[model samples]
Target: MAILKHIANKSADYGKVLDYMLFQHDDFTKKELLDDKGRKMLREEYYIDGMNCEAMLFDEECEMVNEQYHKNKRYDEIKSHHYILSFDPNDKEDHALTGEKAQALGLEFARNNFPGHQALVCTHTDGHNGSGNVHVHIVINSVRKLDVEKQDFMERECDSRAGFKHHLTNNYLRHLQQSVMDICQRENLYQVNLLSPAADKISEKEYWVNRQGQDKLNELNKQIEADGLTPSKTVFQTQKQSLREAIAEIASTATSLTDFQSGLLENYNISLIHKRGRYSYHLPDCEKNISERALGAHYGKDYLLQQFDKNTKGLEKENTQPEEPQKPISSSFPNEPDVSTIFNPSYDYGKDPIAILFVQTNLQLVVDLQNCVKAQQSEAYAQKVKISNLQQMAKTIAYVQEHEYGSQENLLESFEEVSAKLTDARKTLKETETSLRDINQQIHYTGQYLANKKVYIQMVKSKNKGKFRNEHSSEIALYEAAQKFLKAKNPDRQFPSIKDLKAEKEKLTIKRSAQKDTYNYFRDYQKELRTVCSNVDSILGISRIRQQEQEKSQDIS
Candidate 1:
């Protein structure tokens, strides 16, 4: 079981495919915090900034909220006002019932373990892998209502952001986690204390072995396949080559019956046999010889006839089947191995997939934010610098117009040069000021993008539900893979070198590029709009003043 939190501006619009992916179910509870109908959850609202709106809640956490409401009467009493808070219980294996239990546990812990003046709970389910590993979401109102605001170490940021008099502490979450563990202990639930050193050691060893073995096996198979063929070789080459070249050179090409047998025996330690009447040959010990599935690679009567037909028709093509395995990789490994002499009984394990996923997603969002902020800041700074230069030019032009002197014959020349310079300098300063204003608008839009990106990653992670790692080493590997697959210019054949593996990082460089570009364009558009609006205002003001003066002159006459 994993616990994750999301603070989204609009909960309904955040995640698109989360409810379906989590296999969440609909329920009509006494207190209906969430309803799962057609891939959407309607949120419960509380008083926030003196307005009634669907409270900002974490995704997939309806049931947990119900359970919490039952345990703590305080939650129900405080949630009378309108504010949005969301919670998601990430479960990926049919564990909604367990999620309910955990939710109950969370409520009891919050009520008895920690004291808060006002609180509310909302829970939803995250469907990962189409399995139900139920998660619980708890949203507590930061306001203490009538209680005295305590300015102490426990005060959290939500207090300031949401405009609450009193602050909330994360100790409430800690206590909830502890309470859930206690319930697990009492109810005999499968408890993997990932934080425990002993458990950590075992997990690391097992995960390493599994990953390394898979990699080595894939590498070996690829090597063998590559070695059997030349770079220029194709399916048609089987017909135009020498018999020996076809059989020995192209591993996929079968020549005489003896050649096939000899190649299999020498390379894979596999032997073939044919019955007295049967045309097809069978590998007697296929399980030991081939890494692929026995049935798929095994030559049957139909395959033999197919190949014969191809030969008779004067067409040549080799078998182009992918490799299979004897058993699933995950099923092949043992849970606990005998390592009494070699390993320690106590070693700390890294965080689980759920925790690691949140951390990575959140961290990536932060990185994107930093990049965005830097770009915006740079553009804004550049605009400021431009404005400064333009202002200097404008001042110089104005000074020249007022102070520079020339003879009556040369006055025309001085006026032409100085007046033109003044007009150009004024225009430059106006454009610079406009650019700066546009940059400011863009910064505001960028902030919105960053906020939305947080919601997007939260939803994406909830859908994945697994494949996250916590170890410094494992985290490095995970991020490197992401970089290769998502960010690399050519990922198919481009693998990061061993030396650079540790240094390589996954980033949303291209992804952020598009977002930043949009923001920047919008910003520029806004700046241009502002300048045009200002020009219009100035023209309107001038026209109004002239009209007023004409009326005054008529009245005076």
Candidate 2:
């Protein structure tokens, strides 16, 4: 699988980004250092290329562009954007992914996505944790230096214009993720669906927090051991992890949302909040609530409800009567009908249509058994085979009737209908999800704009513009980004209020949740239908014959 990660660099010096990629740096402070050989240490194995600028003079070029544009002067202005495309560790062995090939792919990706921006495309053979994944590091100057043709991802006019800072909007990030997936697919390397949300979303920050916490906990445990006492806790749990485990445990057994909420509160001191069809949790001692999006897709309202429904169904099944024991095989076989008559399309049985359908499909199986050379010499074996087929035919009739299918055509048609519904539901869910994401982004930028509006106004009125900007560079950049985003989103310069955006986001989130339920329902229904169809095909020997015919046709071709 190829994983995409984005990091925005705030340092004014662009060389820091390139230096980190090319040289050995202190793990703690990330400062470049010399190797034991008293020389500048380089990465063990890497392939590096520059785009729209010379590799050695990338920082100088970027500085010149910034000077000309009068942008990126603030100390806190984002100087560059770093994107990492990490391939699966197994790809080296499985797909022969090399550093050179990765670097080439990175260059192509940079040229295509971040066109006209000075970029460093480098590929490293190994990662810091010693994972032997061939990963590409794409570092691009935040300020675009040249005018270029507009792309679909370019929303603002400034995006393709010279001296415009690059914007990493939610849509642009999604586009990059899709591009990575496409590249991996085209290269026939290991890939996963990058468009879908992960079941467990652990951000890079959270991962390191957990790791550091664990290390400290281990140290404490060692101290306790040295003092001749057992440590009460052997592991460290981040708040997200605790919330995830609590929710998962309760969702597995809770009968309803109310029950789930109550259980979490009572058992774990966790508060579940469902606001505007979105779920969030507040863990004890945490000042802020964590939304389901942060926890992951699995901890969301839709998935939890689906799990509840599954638990309900499982309980119902458990309460139902047990299946009856199988009947003994009789010694004699009933009068066997002519195989041709049984399978004749025009021949219609007045009742037991399922049984008739089963017999018609299984006719070849019974005939083959009866005509078998080995069976011909064993009377008991022949009798046993006949009895087994009879029992299977009876079960087939019962199974089809229980499912409310009147005939073979009805069963097949039902399966096809459910399959089609599942497909439609999935499409609808995806669209709803996309809309929800857009609304969320809108809400985010709008909030940022509102939060920094006062600071922006102060900066505009300040006597020393450069000094004020440097003092509040972070807020100014955020305000400008949000303002630009709003302008691009609303070309007419009329933007919705933050309240309106939130309302829209809430509405979309509700719709997405409902769509998810519909998708899950249809998906489960389709799975059951598929199982029935597969079992029927297996029992009738239809699948076997189809496979044989396909093989024969392939041979002929």
Candidate 3:
């Protein structure tokens, strides 16, 4: 997924933005790092470029422009706009995304979007919190340097005029996000719909809070382990996460609004507030109530009502008893005995235990086929049909005994079990395949980094550094990207050997093979059970009517 984030800078210093993008910055202080000589330290790994400006002299040119236009004179005036386009970490592994390619895309994006601005387009491979996501930073001077024709995304007259400050509207942000999606699609990279609301809305602040809280919890757990005491809690959940979980749990089973409210209060001590036709939740110890909008669309009133209706229908279906089988009507044809009389002359089919079991189980093979309507028309045909039915009955009985299914319900239960297992097996297989692919990607990148290390080192040491870099730019970018990836994977700076990664890949391949076998086993078992159930239903002439009734009920619902 590629995410676009916008940050408006109010500081008049254009140099600080360029410094932050090009140099190593202190994590907590957000200040550039310096050497003993008091010179800013360039970042170890980054790809820097520019749109409508020199990359190295971005700050100087932007300041000259700002001074010429007298646009960012006041302390409160917006100096620049920073837009970060973060790509999915898997894009590198899955789509062959490199820093050079991302840098080129970033430059293109800046040129197309902020046309008349002195924009610095920088690409970084190392994401915060060791995410290893490749991202691009586009910092455009707030004041346009030149007058230009209006584009479809431009919203105002000043948008195409020089000396006017850049304006960001919600609509413009959406346009930029769409542009990122389009770029990702064109590059065959991993992309997600950035226009839709997230199912779980975690703000940037809340996300960092959760991360910090988890880190603190882990440290606490480490201390407890040092004292030989086991920690009771291993996972940390934010207040919103807890609220979301409570609401989701109750809503899944609640059949009505009252049930939903009461379930939350009784089970989690969370109070529900319905105001202005919207839902909100108040946690037991929280001072303020969190609205449904804060949680996600899934926790909203309309969505919850739909879930409740679905659950109610499911409950009704589960509780409803199966209808009794209807008795066969007698035929009015002359000199022809009806089905009931032909099957049994004196025995009462409605009252007989064996006859009732035959109907309930839908085992047509167990019934006397000689008394069938078609069989009774011919003596020779009746004998042949009886023989066939006897053979089928023996096979059915053997199958039932083999599976230890004493009744129809048992067979149905087995089928359900197999179906569930098959579903789980498929999910596991998919996850395993993903992991295997990740391992292969790791091996590939690790190999690339090792192979191109010498070339990058030579470029750094060469007398004519610019010429060397231009000649071997692709190799250097790949090396840097792979280096950043490996560093993120192993924060201790100990890169794993390619041999070890291949071994891990081999193990994953074996595990995937086993998972595939398990998936196939369940799939085959489910299919066989389904076939048997279908045959029984068809023979009893019950499936078609039952299906029609189900369809009718669905339509009514």
lDDT for model 1 comes to: 0.35
Candidate 1 TM-score, true structure as reference:
0.21
Residue-level lDDT tens digits of model 3 in 1-557: 88888888998777888788888887545877799999989876799887778988888998898889877888888888999999999888756788888999998899888888888989988875457889999999998998989999999999999988898998998899899999988775888999988788888678877877888999999999999987766767789987787688678789999999998887677899999999998987989999999998899988899999999999999789797564443545322222222122233323322111121133333334423543454465466555555445434544554444545665677788778878999999878877876777688789999999999999988999999989999999999999988888789998889888988989998998999988887786677667566645544556778899999999999
| Candidate 3 Cα errors over 4 Å, as ranges | 26-41, 321-557
lDDT of 2 by residue, 365-470 (tens): 2234533533454565466567655555554445565445655576777778777878898888767766765676787899999999999999999999999999
Report residue 493 deviation for candidate 2 (angstroms).
66
Clashes of each: 41, 0, 0
Give each model's whole-structure lDDT.
0.35, 0.79, 0.79
**RMSD for each of the candidates:** 35.8, 19.9, 20.2
- Comparing 1 with 2 on lDDT, the higher-scoring candidate is 2
